[model samples]
Target: MKKTKVKVKRLKKGSNIAVISPSNGLASVFPHIYEMGLKNLSEVFGFNMVEYPTSRMLSKDLYTNPKLRAEDIQRAFQDESIDGIICTIGGYESVRILEYLDMDIIMNHPKFIMGFSDATTFLSYFNKWGLVTFYGPSVMAGLAQMKNMDQSYEKHLKDMLLKNNKSYVYKPYKQYTNGYKDWSDPELVGQCEAFYDNENGFEFYLDDEPSEGELWGGCIEVLEFIKGTKYWPEPDFWYNKVLFFETSEEKPSPMAVGYMLRNYGIQGILNSIKGLLIARPKDYTEEEKEDLKKIVMDIMTLEFNVKDIPVVFNMDFGHTDPKLILPLGCVVRIKPKENCIELVESPYTNKNK
Candidate 1:
């Protein structure tokens, strides 16, 4: 696959961000939360956010409707004033919209795009096209936290997207949350799930040294769904990449994770990539995390016959609250000895450069 031109530029204060619903539009389901997110993007983050044609159109029908979602994305990029794009939130079926995407349009008018979970479908796609797409935060998912923001998340995101900082070292969340109260209840607005301390930091496995590469991969569930589709890339495409993986709220079992890793090994992808970075699974017990680690390691080493692949787990990103943004295709150094992930290059280029 030939790489497309990368036109991603750093976002500045007051950059117009098109809020599009490439997947589920929770904004339609919970209008108050959506409005709150819009307010924060404007007032707190100093961004000019614009809603596209179907940003608030919620339903399985529209989500499955590829042309509508694709048009929103195309329009967002075609609009000269829009500097970035954000998904309203993730859902079960973002892959459905891939066929309708005008890749020529996306390639010709590249811009920053942000979202994760099912949004991974687009994140990985754009990365393969050589455009930087973020794999963290969404309107309904990350913004609108009541009364407080995760200081680390806010700073890192601002530094990269708003300030154009090139260097960063990731630190584990001092506290993290996987708890979710029902969003259907109006009283739960701006409410946070219970949080517990994450004192141990990243769990380094295999070779706990350092590996540098552009980041790849996204939500495992979405990756599985898109496999063998036109959107899926070859093993050679993953060469010299630091692949990241996270489970969605669905939280498949440990055995299922083994199968996914095994499939990668079968495709000869495991040995080709430089490293692996796994997120703390949503709502998993400590025991389950350990189990997952063992399963993946066993398959990669014993079953797949690959060794010293450089793996890390329990990083602070994905479905969890207070998650960090990872711009796919950005250069990052995964240093297990330092217990951190470091950005080596700004994820953006100058507009005129």
Candidate 2:
């Protein structure tokens, strides 16, 4: 299949960004975070946040209803005033609304759409329609970051959303943090830092020295949730793709991760990819992390048997703090020897021109 060039438009100051609840209705339950996120957009990012019908609706029960969530997404995409869309929070039911989305409407207005975790389903849809979407910080996750947005995270996000750049380098942060605190607690809000070390960086075991291709994939659990549905692309569609995957907060067992990878191997999906990027597994215990990594390596080596494939472990992108913003369906180049990952194509067109 011929690849399409993605045009990333620049986001100017004071642009309107729509905050929609496409997954879980966290906005309804934790209105404070939603408000803080919006405030950050206006005060910090210099962008106004537009809240739709479901933005503030906090009923966990209502979130399970896919049609309602789909309506929120459709309305946001159809609105001409909104410059881009950002998800509120990620939840399991996001895949349920896959069929309800009007891809035609989304395709016509290809603006900045950002999310991760369950949002992978939407990203896959956009990829199928030849559109570029972001697999990074969400409103609640990044904008409403516990204290303030991580400097490393904020930088990459701005680069992707505001500055149309072909490629950017990612460096590990000195610290990492997560969870929420009272807004009134100034110390708590401002002092939260992530767990980071100087040793953090990209390490690739590659059969091929250097490789480049369009980047794809997201929360592995979310991808599996939408598998066999209309949202999933044909198996062969992932051929020669640079697949980037990360685990979620739930931290499923190592066996679970291995099973999923084994399935992909069985389907011949592993052999067709140009490379693979796995984020640091967010398991609770140190032992679990080791086990999960072991499981992943074993599956990739034994099941896939594509030992030469470039694979990077412990790269930040998943349910971790100080995350890097990834452009879904955008071309990225990976050099294993140099341990460098570079974006080689623009995901949007010129917005400033």
Candidate 3:
């Protein structure tokens, strides 16, 4: 039997959001970007930003004490006043904090929790426990750079986080940037690097027919860290799910990404999933993107003999600027004829009641 999903309350203008550094303590290292993100959450989103204990702790201290990081997450969930929780930034070793987390406290007091990249560890785990989690944006990454990106991004964030729309269609941004300019430069704070035209919003390699499934997945690299651990989902979890994945700024080569996807084929995940959504990689060239897609198709069709599933590439999420938030456990539909993706259900339990 499927577990009933624990829905969170809708966040409004005055809602209080707890900010934590569950991953790398980049907030302490780069206070400018972090502070700018908090400011945008306040001025733009109208959120009351509350900083947790680990939000600005030193990187060395945070790395040495995973328990402390987990405690901050627990305390935030325990706090009734906090309407939601967001990460300060993403780090590589946040998986270490998972063992120390109190699942009971988290599941019982389910509220809004959003992050990406390294956040995949807890977000994916929580969804497995039947709690909806968000895989989009962190403070220093997406949020801080918001003011400098397209207005569509700000609208997208507000729509996903604030509005309780029964159905929402994701529209690709008019433009995109690979990454931020420089966090350390006072003048360059909150500015992205170069901008590129989003000529092809969402390219579909396979769209035999429209399909719908619960949304799940995160940074592809981050998912690898928990593959064999207790936090990894069971073999049956992939069934009837739309798995979304994206690469980070590290820019794993096309061949490297192919190896990762090949593992999914081996695990029978490619056959089990309803559809596959690949976000535009952080800093890949046009040729590299084509190579990645070809490798993915080869793995699914030639290697695994699975070709019916809908495959979408270059989605506007993950490391790209002007992100569209994807809520895990929410049902989303892909309409081949319409060439569009739609969130078929409201992620929140309240539904703006």
Candidate 4:
């Protein structure tokens, strides 16, 4: 796919932000945290909250129906009152909804769409439409962090959603909240342990010297499952692109990561990209994190032969707290020698009246 520049629009205060669930309907089951997320958006972020038909609907059978899930997303984008769209939470089966979405509607609006985990499916779709979408923090997860949202996480979100800065330096937080609180007890709402971080910053490697390219890719597992599907781009689409991906709580085995990378190599996907951003590994234990990192790096070097490819590890933009919102279709600069990564465009584009 040829690179096309789409200017992102800066949203003003008081604009209505639409919150919808395109994946699992967790909002219906966990109304406490869901409502808490709404409160933060209205009272803290100062945006009017809007909900869709299935925004808070709960059904054991709905999980198996991908059509209904896709309808909710279509309705949200068609509503002109909505200035932006956010997912309520992430879950499996989001990939199933890909066939039901109206790409024309989403591309026409070109509004800000944000989510991670399963949300990566929609993000990739939006990218194919030539629109930039966000991959980071969900409504109930990051925005509704108990006690309060992480200061750094909130800051990065505000910067991307409201401002137009071309460069943002990611900072790892010393502590993070996983949103593990007693839902039955209202008093336990805002309680969580602060995750400690001792790392200084991301480590980058430049393969063909400094290079810039359009950002692509998402959660590694999600991409693999949809690899052969129509939703995934062709081999040439990934050529010379900047690939960014992170793992989820399932804690995929190191062998699994290598297999996926090897598949990309076989498909000629690995050699086509300008850079790669592999986020910090999430596992059951700290030792597992270390083991996964070593395995991933070795695969990149040996199997993929992307030795000079600038790869940055431990960036806070995945399942971890205090995550940074990454623009999927935006131009990203990767300087491996300097150990720096910067976003060069806004994700939102103005709709001409």
Best by TM-score: 3
Higher-scoring candidate on TM-score, 1 or 4: 1
Instruction: Point out the higher-scoring one by TM-score: 1 or 2.
Output: 1
Cα lDDT tens digits for candidate 4, 37-122 = 88877876688888876678675545777788888787777788877788888887788888888887766666777899988888
Top candidate (lDDT): 3
Q: Model 2 — TM-score against the truth?
A: 0.91
Q: Residue 332 in model 4: shift from native, Å?
A: 1.5
- Model 3 per-residue lDDT at 318: 92
**CA lDDT scores, all candidates in order:** 0.81, 0.75, 0.91, 0.73
Model 1: lDDT equals: 0.81
On a 0 to 100 scale, what is the lDDT of residue 183 in model 4?
60
Residue 218 error, candidate 1, Å = 0.8
Off by over 4 Å in 2: 1-8, 146-150, 178-194, 351-353
For each candidate in turn, the TM-score is 0.95, 0.91, 0.98, 0.91
Off by over 4 Å in 4: 1-8, 59-61, 146-150, 177-179, 182-184, 205-209, 350-353
Q: Candidate 3, residues 1-47: lDDT per residue as tens digits? A: 36678888989999999999999999988899999999999999899
* lDDT (Cα, tens digit) per residue for candidate 2, span 154-220: 7766676777666676655556554344545545543334454636567676465888877889999
Assess candidate 3 and give its lDDT: 0.91
How should the candidates be ordered by lDDT, best one leading?
3, 1, 2, 4
Better of 1 and 3 by lDDT: 3
Candidate 1, residues 158-209: lDDT per residue as tens digits? 7767766667777787888884556777778666788888888888888876
